[model samples]
Target: MPTGNTVSDGVGAFQSREQIILKDKKQLDCENAQDDDNDGHYKATHPTSYMDTMLHLFRGNIGSGLLAMGDAFRNGGIIFAPIMTAVLGVICVHAQHILLNCSEEMYRETKRPKPPGFADTVSLVFAHGPVKLRFLAPTMRAVVNAFLCITQLGFCCIYIVFIANNVKMIADQYGITIDLSIHMIFVIIPVLISCMIRNLKFLTPLSMIANVMMAVGVGVVLYEAAQDLPSIQERTFLASWQQLPLYFGTAIYAFEGIGLVLPLKNEMRKPELFQKPLGVLNVGMAVVGCIFISMGFLGYLKWGEDVAGSMTLNLPRGQILSSVVQALIALAMLFTYPLQFYVPMSITWPGLRKRFGPKALVAKELGYRAIMVMLTFVLAQSIPELGLFISIVGAVSSTTLALMFPPIIQLVHEGHRNRLTKYIVIKDCLILLLGALVFTTGTYESLSAIIKFFRKES
Candidate 1:
């Protein structure tokens, strides 16, 4: 049976023997500790510097999901796309800050290590100090973890699928028919790589690869935009009213993964030194947004919405350039899968640690890794693929996590003072309402699209 820290021996079968002893000591000490409010000594070890933390957070934010930007741009339109994306970025930044502040407060007041659920922990902190959380605490906490789980797991699958699709893209350039089984290879390859490693440090180079590709990819798009400058008046002014929505929607997708940056502050060695990761988030998101939209606006101007997967594929078919772009894009996808997987893994870590002994934890972790591989396998094999499912998930969950959570967290942290409450609460209510509307509408549209496609198939 699982105790507070010491899990069953069978659980640690895959963990190294040393790991078993260390984890046992850690768990035993934690469980036996008397201070419920003091989170103990974990925070003191290995604090990351602010700049390093920011870099890590920035990469973590985008993960693999930005690959879907071209597809979202295919649907939302160019004019409103950047604007909406900026708005979402602002909301995400504010919400993330609020979550962190609440997390810090909970640590201070409750003396609890960060609560298990993001929202729950915040609500508990708020509820403790004269805020009548009565029902909202548990509701918000459940919402946070549930949606977070879906987003994390779904993102992992999304990246794996992208990897498979990217590999197929490469195969096509070589005059080979890509195997349908290529999808399974992507899943298995990454899972094996990630599972064998002991720390995330091994994946840092991959993160750098992702950052470089994102930068180069954006630069290429901006270059394309420069080429279209002469026709900008015509394209910008006279682009059809009908095309606008598609452009904007797609641009929003480019900016969707901003939430991945949140945990860095607490994880950092000197979280206080960096001010907050918000500045990094804002700058990174802006750079990413501009490059993505410019690519879409220019690529759409040059190649139109029919561009699949990435705008890079539409580059003039020169052997060296085409092969390089495809390889880079594939590497970007490979880098992305782990970044996305890390989020869920963080959430899953506690459960895995408790259920299995440290020694066997490696195998259980691999088992979890296997589950993600299976999910990717299923998604890739499903005929008549769809792009909007990612958006639907993003719009719905991100909306709640981004737009609603911030103000709610703030309200919890600082008790409701009627005068200030009226203004802030009302504004947040509207923001939340708008987010809900967009998410619901987007979900309905995606579902309808799926149904229509399946009906035709039938």
Candidate 2:
């Protein structure tokens, strides 16, 4: 009887263990199915087509910076401006390629999802890199995030100055005197409301409207500029060599779309097509470079050292059409403020959320954005030098984000196996050197110019 009881107990235990295993398996399967559904929902709602990706790239790059290209040409002159534009274009494209290649290789090796942004890429590189460097991965991620936040905020500051200057110019033309700071204040509420939006995909309609306004504004400005083209013989082919640093700052600022590249790629309906030969990036950047070159060359040729900080500002004040263009461009940038602010908010909000907890997330986020807008408004009021501010930010933040990080990440990812040829390594080193040079020199030049301007104003 005892032997029979022992057999029966063993059988009951085995059956219980099997039941537990089956329950666990079902739970796991359900969780996986839920994850798959979430991913599918995301793709369904946010999938961007090839052309849409191209448009987003263009929209991001060809902002207020494009209007400043003519001023950039004033520093580099005709010959150097076009040449440097092309060179920078190629360098920007190559740097993007390096980033994408490294991302793909890392994804393959780790069998993980590729990084989705510039900061994420930096963190991934350091995390999966040499054993010694793995410890610094979190710090490096913070650094990249800091740079991105600063860059986007810098953009906000520039937009404020841009809007203020243009609006003040129009107000003055009508014999209405209002401080630029007041104009800056006028747009704050609108910008703050726009920043309340949490999802980037939802901003697509606003982006499209802004793009149209910008296109129309550019057309009007170009038409106005072309009507009074100065003699080619009269214009200088080369500028003072000392001014080259300023040119580097401005042109680099114009092409600083590297931050947007990966995000655009990650959101695409068919991401693989983004990296193909003659793909979205290449085509989009090519068009962007052409637009910059043409605008700078033609505007400078027409104005011949008389162009203002923005091409729109240089438009005839007496013309109603010029006023209309200014307003349109201002509106375009007004809409773009949120798009630019999105990166900084995404980076900074998580920390804020952690501190405040999930229950108050929306309130905290909106409050944070409002504070950011007010801060930018105050800075714009203080400095009020749109061109100089743009150059300084581009030199300090854009150079690091666009030119410095990519090659370093590539080297780290490739390791010591010399997977990259010696020639490639040498080339990357050269690029790094160039970035460092631009950052140091351009920063100094921009700061000096700003200080002098402020002193004069005082």
Candidate 3:
């Protein structure tokens, strides 16, 4: 297998086609080395199984966003809710396929194996493109890294808001009226502690616990929602067209799991299974889309125009079941905060470590993580509109990462002259237009909603 030294040498000799092709066998060795080391986290012999990959994707996709689908449905109505959910699901899966295909082509041409992260993939794609485009490669990498950082930090902020809002709800039930910022401060300590964990594998048990809690909470929510289903005549069949932006934002946010796709695929023992017709990515996302559709339809049908930012908040308070569901969700978010925090930390630490030197690597990483958690807390407190914040981040950051980048990457990878390329280019261009529409309109609506909410509060 190719050692660390060979991998470094292969990347350095990226401009040499002859060298790369000659080193194809050695690059295969690098893949075997990566599989053995499992990205330096898992033991070489115990790589992730296909089932584990599916479960991880499912878990990653079904987080705080699932709880907001009911609110999204309230904006779009029953007619648009299920339809939009399915459409967004298909779009998300297609983008993931684009990334996978591009990565595979890059491997075949360069014999360098696939990049482990999104930013790396972007860098590699541009670096291997035409001579004129090579100079922009570093800039493209920076942009991807910036979006990844923003997307992950956005998730951390959402977790803080989610935890604070739920805790405030529970506290108000006991006649304790604490400020939301105070509740936010209360949650930050545990998040700070959790962020100190530097390894992803160490959090596997916590991830499993989070999955179970979320499953139970969602079940209770569905049961409560079903208990008070309104008649068909009482429900609106269609929402105003202006509200479509909000629906777009929320649906994209809820279904955007594109960030997790590459990482999971790269780690899989049977990496080839990730992109098949009925493979892990498609199956996992199908399940997630179904859950969102069901939750949004049933929850909106039950609560009509009164569904809160999260359906859990719409549940009857002071009841044991409602309290349990809320608390469980908070716990789930607490566990999830660290997982989300890890991504940005991983991205940021290398630069910091280079400056600070290797001796203080652990200290610098932990310190950086703690500061990031605090920053998220501060951001959460500033714009405490949980649903609107989610929509804004989804529109601006998640949509860019999940919807925009994949098509652009594919277009760049496949030049625009061939007959076969015509159809592919047309499809990708349409997807780009859709992403731009969502980013512009959804961002406006989300920001407008936040402004109106705060104006009323003030």
Candidate 4:
């Protein structure tokens, strides 16, 4: 008696609650499972109930990436930030809708349920053939995974670096000179503990903690900004507009996590309920964005160009509350890092294991983990700057993932005939171009800054 079942639809088979839970954990393993059907869909051992599915969707879209928004606005300007963000949001939503439609179409056409994993399900629909080394399809897939892997890993590193640097910055206020190595150790120890844990389920509570931290941090910062605004000089709105382009990229980056849940549709108990999570996730992201935009606007309005990565510095130095705000933001980013690394790592794993060997092989797992950790350490060392790292992550990676891939996938998946498809393709391409411009501009600016610093040192 599920609501959607019509008279014309055959009565569906029902299962007991015990059947769903699977008493024997080893028997419920993913690798041992039979394929759902001949058309490439594989049944999941533990289907995520519709409610959990929705939560996962939202969680996938909310992460530490939002830390970049202020810096993006700093460079792109206020006008550009909001405009691009609205545009990008619409495009991503449309692409996600199209992807869902494609999934439904494939289900009907093939009469086979979709696979458990997101990427695998999508590949069944639009994947060309075996990606031989010389084949274009394989090459494109490789490039996409490579870009995704590098971006996520880099963002993950930035999270640790941001936390450590913020810690250092706060300590400086009290004249505490903590050595850089000790600061890094503090950041790494927590991350290492989290990373070494095997199960994704174990991290769910941590995810909730991170989300609450974001909400509270944004709340505290905005409250502080509003109270302080009265004493600060009123600035012209035109100046905010003039600097808009530099910051728009940052705001868009805040919402970059919105669509990452698309690939997991098949695992949902009620596949149709996927949209609920998508909605929840966006609502959460929008709330965060509002807090960031308001705080960034007020902070910039008050402090002008002196505003650095952490807006807490802009508040009166003696304000203990502002210091607490700074610490919370860093902690939130620390919580966000695991999720960021996790996404790309998920994608990278299948490809890497195929290239290397079986997943049971410890060497492969250890090697990949070591590489990821080492790269994070290197970025933390070289940059030693938090906001700058955020800008780099948002400008480079978020641009490609958020703006570029959605439209490209739509064009390829939904062919040109559909009006909605055509509209999305056009609209997303323009937004993608805007993102590309931000990427190029941000890269150039960072390079210029690095060059200037080196020249001065010499």
Candidate 5:
């Protein structure tokens, strides 16, 4: 989930035809596993149970992004961070519901036994949507997939930056003087091999290891952050207006797991159980939100304005426990690298198939993998700010994908059915505006900070 391409794959170490989403698995896995039955409906050979779906939902939504909650609180202040996080959490969950409902509506309308992936749903919604929007189906699909590529690759960039930042901090503890950029360059070794990994099956074990490491790492981080904390009055309840958007970007990126919802629900043994008042998605997200709120509150209370991009990096230096957490988190990101890389690689690689010709998929993919992996490393080296980098991706891409699109799709779908209500328009419009605001302000502040930092660093 932390490494989620939201593509949510490869040949040699770098090629997969499989569509493995960070919902933990690709929607294609479930779809491809089922055969067309006599009733014309598709069913999974081994569908996931309610609890299973809940676990997937939890794993998919929360990951490295949660690690930044402390920094986000630094930006938003204490009281407002939790309050706004709760509000945004509810909106994010509602967006997921909107996406799921739209996809199900498409299935019922078209009588398609198979449930569509997120991008497919966008295309189909447009195709069957209002007359003006029907012509935009292909365009919409490409747009959705394009953002998927951007977001997933963006996640990869953040991973590289995060790994480099923490590892460099640990290296500093031992009087090691390797520059941050050098650490990122060294990352090229394993990331290339991992990205070249051709099979999703192989990544499963690596991903499991990452999950375990992250669990331990996050637990250690939270435990340490909660200790020797300052009084509530020490930190502002509301931060400066300019910094609030960074908080929005951070929180949205952490919560925007809407991409995982449809894919998870589609593969469930009882899909209806997914959208109930007490559904898997709701309960899981609720718990994750509480964790995020707690982490932000505690981390900020502990470190105040000085918290690092990741709380793990803020642990007291020279302690074995602190160093262990840093190492675990770094290793966790490394293992998950391949899964995130394959997402955008899968989406864009197909478009280049004709250029490379059919016979060259393997060689072509090998070259492509090298280029994409390097690109992520390059981007990370350039920006080199973990918390701000995460905010930029969340602002520019995640917000659009998670917030902007759902409302638009809902409007189009509802309009297609002649059920478009004024309240619906008003509600969704407000959400879209909120997303736009975050995108604009967050992008401005993050980019400005990076530029200023580069001027000083260089």
Candidate 6:
């Protein structure tokens, strides 16, 4: 959904390992002017500018999943959606800070060569905790990386369907109707080819193009969505209990960019600027929040129950601007797919690299990339219901990464530090409970909705 100023900062859910570490490899040896600071080693290599960091934060949090906020609103209500979005945005921001705080504690504790990746932080926290739980360290690390794969690949699946849906709409307008699955099949080859591009440098131009196109496309969508809106009094304040999970799933998916946080902060010149009030995280997320709320509010009031999975689809047909917007955004996502694929590939490749045992490593990596690309295409083709698929992924993978993991990590780490308190326990328990509720019910409802969609199609 989002592309950044830098390939590493902008392309997808998580930055490419190569992209993130390309500069940091020097940081391991170079010295910065943080003589009194704890993160002196890591912060020593501060090449990223503040404005660049803010842009990365904003772009990282906003993406193709953003367009679905309208359908999310349709599931909740006209009034309820915006309020919940603001609330969720605040929670997501808090979770990021919780994660940042945990990592800061670990940075001081471990005093390793460099900053820990998400997986490393989880492992180190659990491994150093109470002895009984130490054995779970590897498992927790695997779980975090596994969900990273699932979450990014899930976003790739979304991009495929999104691109196909946009293309199909254009074709349908020209009397060239085709099945959505068929459109996804067409996406597999190009996406597969794009994944072969291993150089992060090569992705920069693509990212730039994608960002510009998406900016224009979203502006047009907002413009069209704001037109001829109905009164708020006519819409429901809240939807039925069954639809609440769907809304939760969609909202989570829309707000999540958790994996990008640490890497972005670690890459910054002043990592301290990323935290607290008036910081980049707060300011950027506030902007992201307003945009999301506006998109949902206007798109819902403009289209009500009939809002498509992407509000872009609900734009007036037969208009050249509409077709151009669709095509442009579709192409933008096309450019972003490789960046998205790179994260999972980075995580999944390390295991595969160990498995290779020196049997033509490069060739094996390329082949593995192809299989994963096709895998996303196949998954998208199977369900092919963009809205429901977004919800399911949000409910399952995004919820795990965002809600379930952060609080538990904090609790475990706090216990290890003898800092655990009654209030912390209570608050963490509530977050975990909410995560569990959303994961179970949202997955069930979204899957049921997908089933019904297929039944109706048949």
Query: So what's the TM-score on candidate 3?
Result: 0.88
> lDDT per prediction?
0.50, 0.73, 0.73, 0.52, 0.79, 0.79
Residue 147, model 2, lDDT? 77
What lDDT tens digits, residue by residue, belong to model 4 across residues 220-324?
755665664533334433334324433544555555542344444555555555565454334544554454466556665555566666564455664677678
Candidate 5 clashing pairs? 8-21, 9-16, 10-15, 10-16, 11-15, 13-196, 13-197, 14-196
Where does candidate 2 stray beyond 4 Å?
1-46, 113-115, 197-204, 358-362
Q: Which sections of candidate 4 miss by over 4 Å?
A: 1-63, 78-80, 106-112, 115-135, 179-182, 230-248, 263-292, 312-318, 349-364, 416-425, 453-458
- What is the C-alpha local distance difference test score of candidate 3? 0.73
Question: Could you tell me every candidate's TM-score relative to the true structure?
Answer: 0.75, 0.87, 0.88, 0.73, 0.93, 0.93
User: Mind giving the per-residue lDDT tens digits that candidate 2 earns over 357-456?
Assistant: 8787787778888898888888878778876877787789888877899989887877643577787789889999999999999999988898899899
Report the Cα lDDT for candidate 1: 0.50
Worst 10 residues of 2 by lDDT: 1-10
Candidate 3 backbone collisions, by pair:
36-44
Give one digit per residue, the lDDT tens place, for model 6 in 294-350.
Answer: 988888888888898888899889999999999998988898888877877776777
- Model 3: per-residue lDDT, tens digit, 307-405? 877788887988877888999988877876776666567667766777988887787777777788889888998899877877888888878988899
Best of the two (4, 5) by lDDT: 5
139, model 2: CA deviation in Å?
1.7
**Residue 212's C-alpha lDDT in candidate 3?**
78
Give a tens-digit lDDT track for model 5, residues 129-227.
Answer: 777778999888889888877888888898888888888889999999898999998877889988888766678777777777888998999898878
Q: Which stretches of candidate 1 lie above 4 Å from their native place?
A: 1-54, 63-65, 111-132, 135-139, 179-193, 196-202, 208-230, 233-253, 256-262, 267-289, 349-365, 383-386, 415-420, 455-458
TM-score: model 2 vs. ground truth = 0.87
